[model samples]
Target: MNVLDLLEQWKQSDTFNNTLSDDHQVISYQEAYLRISVYSDWLASNSFTQPMAFYCAQSIEHLLMLIALMFNEVNFVLLPVKSTDVDKELFADQLTLKPHFCDMLRHIQLTKQAQCKTVATPGRIYFKTSGSLGTPKLVVHQRHNLIANSRNVLTRLPLNASSRVLIPVPMHHMYGFGAALWPCLLVGASIHLTSNLNILRFKAVERQFAPTVAYLTPSTVGALLLRSCKSSQYEFIVSAGDCFDRQTFQQAQTKFGRVFNLYGSTELGVVAIGEIQSKGEAVDDCVTALPGVKIKIESEQIAVKHPFGFDFYLYQQTRDVFFNTGDLARGDEITGFSVIGRAKLSINREGRLIAFSELESQIKQHQHIQDVALVKGRKDSKGHTIVAIVESTTELAPDELRRQLGKFLPRYATPSKIIIEPQLPRLVSGKINRKQIALHYEETEF
Candidate 1:
């Protein structure tokens, strides 16, 4: 269903009283739609003939403006940075939304209009991929397709008007926007959004909002487990953006009753979700593809063709029928498939290819280690050396870690050098920032 139809359905429902909230304030669906109506009217009055870029933090105002922009059929790009931080010269062609306070309609301001070839299409939504591996690029999606992707999520985890969702991730990211927010809105669920959530803040929010569902990252799950908060069980919880090791998955399932691992990419919206195993069974990593989505393991890399996948990257119109997601996977559609690691990040060692994700998972098994990240170092006679940076509960000498890894891993698979730290660098989505880690250890001798 389109957003307008969804909103109309919400208006006729008993849960029109259900609320959407941010750290700033709480407003019912009635109030939210009223504000959106006002914003839409104002946006319609203004004749916007050019493409625009919107850069705002995750707030109710940001969401209202986004809906209003779409409502008025004004094509715009959703930037990942705040307006104040954006480089005006770089995006001079497209109009830009000026920074504003809470008032969405009154505070609307746009930069001087100019031609922008990248965002020529009207009635489209745009997002930028997190440049963890390289430079960030704009990803474009059809507005209707985005809604369709959200519907795919419902095939697995259904929501209701009574559902209360806690979203701590940034709305600019696809995980938060497409997977969580749109689905919640479609079901008229009570929503509460927060930023930079830690265990203490999480507990406080839980008590205040009484959230029945949450969108979380692996690191956030680790923090909740670390605190041993005895958090109340909910309908279900979703963990995505990166893979979760077996131990974390088991602990989360025990604590949360039902924890689902979502396997998707910025390109393909909600591809598949890990199937829920029967009670008392070990948690499985294998995920089944969502409705109308095709998945194949070609040359060990995951290839996807989703009805709701993004159209193309900015300035790059040509696209393959089946997008080759750089992630490696094994298994099939019937039994389900397991996403292993990034295809580009796999390292060759002594005629053997080792996935860094598998290597880190093995290193995390060490009793002293809390987390691990593998970085590809300079090539040696045997192969490219691997640098292992570990976050440990207690201080572990480099020699001691090597000795412990030697017991489980083959000699070629063990890290050539080890760096012990209090914590490993991570993105907000909980994926390791390998580029940052490599830059930090560039000068060190192995």
Candidate 2:
């Protein structure tokens, strides 16, 4: 069913409660239903259609715009709030979708002239990657696929009329859509939206909303643990979009009590989830697969089969139904599985292939290294440098670290330069901001 039908049903039911606060405003089932209906009506009066581009920041307006589009069975391209002019132009040219800039506080009448013609009707939502790994690709997901995937996630953490879901990530990203927003909407749970990552704001939101659960990234969870907060503030925390380090996991457990790690990507939603007891232990086997979704490993690459998995881009030439996620994974009969690392990040230096994740794991083993990212840099006089951008707690000479890596890695694989920074810049999802790091190194003398 379309999102509007669900909303209409919930609005008439007694389960609707429209209580939300400025600090901790949560959309009750009823309020969410009413708001979505109002927005849908407004969009219908205006000329809104499927396959449009939504360009806006993370706010109530953003959420409402998405809901309106979904209600109308419109497929939208989510333009990141920080998108550059180049990004917008390229997206428009490629997708052939017209842009919709949201103005929430004001009601502006939209006309049919504003609507963009649909280029392709894959009957799915499209999301763009960060383009850090390479050029950004549009990932297509069916509405039913999302609903099915969300049902699987709900099996792990059931939602109901009494449940409140705190959304820390932007709705555009798959993590935000699958984990926080869609799941709540599916089960009549309250949704509390917060764009700020400030610890005080998080604490205040939790205290005021009393949300039963929340979705967070590793970096956000770490930051929350570092701050002063009561353990009883949250029942459970779900981490996704990036790996959760051991220290951060422990710190969160100490602060918030329960933490769960989610694994998936834009191509595949909610592949697996496990309770993180400590970072050192293997990720638990407990995982719930969405209905009609199947997982398998073909030559170490995580491959997925589902009715909804579509092309990397709407304009792309290739059309492979099964997605081959470039991730190494392992599974046992009893424990299920866990993703080891990305296949693209694996490097070949001096005739030896070394996984970037392995290199990162080794570097993070250092007591002073809080976080590190290893990327292949331009070939220098001493072969390809495994450049390491490190977030360090204490001073560590680059020469010394290079010497340490040489013992395990080949001489050629040893990092030629170790750029120490106070903190690693991260994407909104809290993954290492590789694009920013590349820019940083470009400006540096080394």
Candidate 3:
């Protein structure tokens, strides 16, 4: 069913009696509907026609704005207000500018705005990858994709009526919106939306709500472990979108009980799910694919054709039959698949190819390494040197980290530059803005 159909179903179900809550307030679905109705009335009164962009700042308002837009059939973009290295011009000429948010919409002078395409049908949600890396283009999904993507998570995961989900991730991200938020909405389960994701706020969420499910990333889990969180019980924690360190997974499993690894991307919904019990996973490192999702290891890269595949492009307006996830992997449909690394991120050091993710993952295994990001360094007559930007507590010398790296990686796989930093800049989705980091070093150090 489409978003409108789902909304209508919820209106008729007991879900209307349930509540949607955040850090600050709690409102029933009925109340949310009324507020959305008022906002819808406001939009209609103002003749809102352009494809809007909402600076989704973790609140009930952000959630309601999405719902209201979906109902109003307004094409929109959700930009995280706090993401690092975000292109300020990512939405230029593509959206009705700010000052249109909240109360300012009525006051802003009308300008030539980009008009949204008049589609005869519903379920056209627009999403763009974190634009730090390249020219950000909108990845579009239709109604069936929305439902199928949500169901892929809902079916595999064990959320129930009693479950209370703690969402520290932003709703703009597919990991957060599709996998985390959609299931809660579909199941009529309780959700506590946090204004920000941090150790203090995370503890506060647990202390206040006693939530059963948590949507987290590798970096957030690392932050929690670094803060020495108490061993807690959770139904399951889904980790996605980045290279989750094996050690961090063990620590998270110890702290949160069961940690489930969900593999997917913004272009495609979740491809697989696996439970981690210890430091070492299965030899194949298998993760079962969702029903109707066909996965193939074409030339060692994971390619998937699923119902949730982004059907249309907001700008290009074309459809891709299959999404070739640039990730490298090995497995059959029966054996499932394991992500090796991203094809584009592979570096050639002295003509010996080294997958950057493998190098970064190896470095992250260091006891002192809290977080690590890999970027290509200077190129001369020699070869392209791999750089490792590391986040650690104690002072680190390049030589020492190199020595540590020698223990795990081969000579060629060892990073050429070891820059110690207090922290690496990351997108709101928790993946390191590698393109930004590479560009920064290219300008300064190279």
Question: TM-score: which candidate is best?
Answer: 1
Order the candidate numbers by lDDT, best to worst.
1, 3, 2
Q: Model 2: per-residue lDDT, tens digit, 1-446? A: 77755766556544567443233234455555566677777666654344556664556545766766666766667767565532333222221112232346254333233334345363567788644322467776677767777767777665665666688777777778877777777666667777776778876786777777788876567666655646665677787644555556667777666777777777776776777665346334234345566777777677777554545565675755667777777773135556656677665443234667656776777777889987767643223457888897666677786677677654655677787778899999989988777676742534
- For candidate 1, the TM-score is 0.74
Per-residue C-alpha lDDT of model 1 across residues 321-345, encoded as one tens digit per residue: 8899888888886668887767776
TM-score of 3: 0.69
lDDT for model 3: 0.68
lDDT, residue 371, candidate 3: 88
| Model 2 lDDT on a 0 to 1 scale | 0.63
- Output the lDDT of residue 44, model 1: 67
lDDT of 3 by residue, 1-446 (tens): 53456668676656777777887678887777776776677656765444455556666766776666666766556667554443433332232223223454442233434443433233466676743223455677764576568877877888766677888777887777888887787777778887557788787778877877888876677776666655555777887644455667767766777777788777786778776544346322357788788887878977788877787655576655777777787676676666766677765443244667656766888988988988777754234677788888757687787787887776767777788888888899998888789887752445
* Ranking of all predicted structures according to TM-score, beginning with the best and ending with the worst: 1, 3, 2
Q: What is the lDDT of candidate 1?
A: 0.75
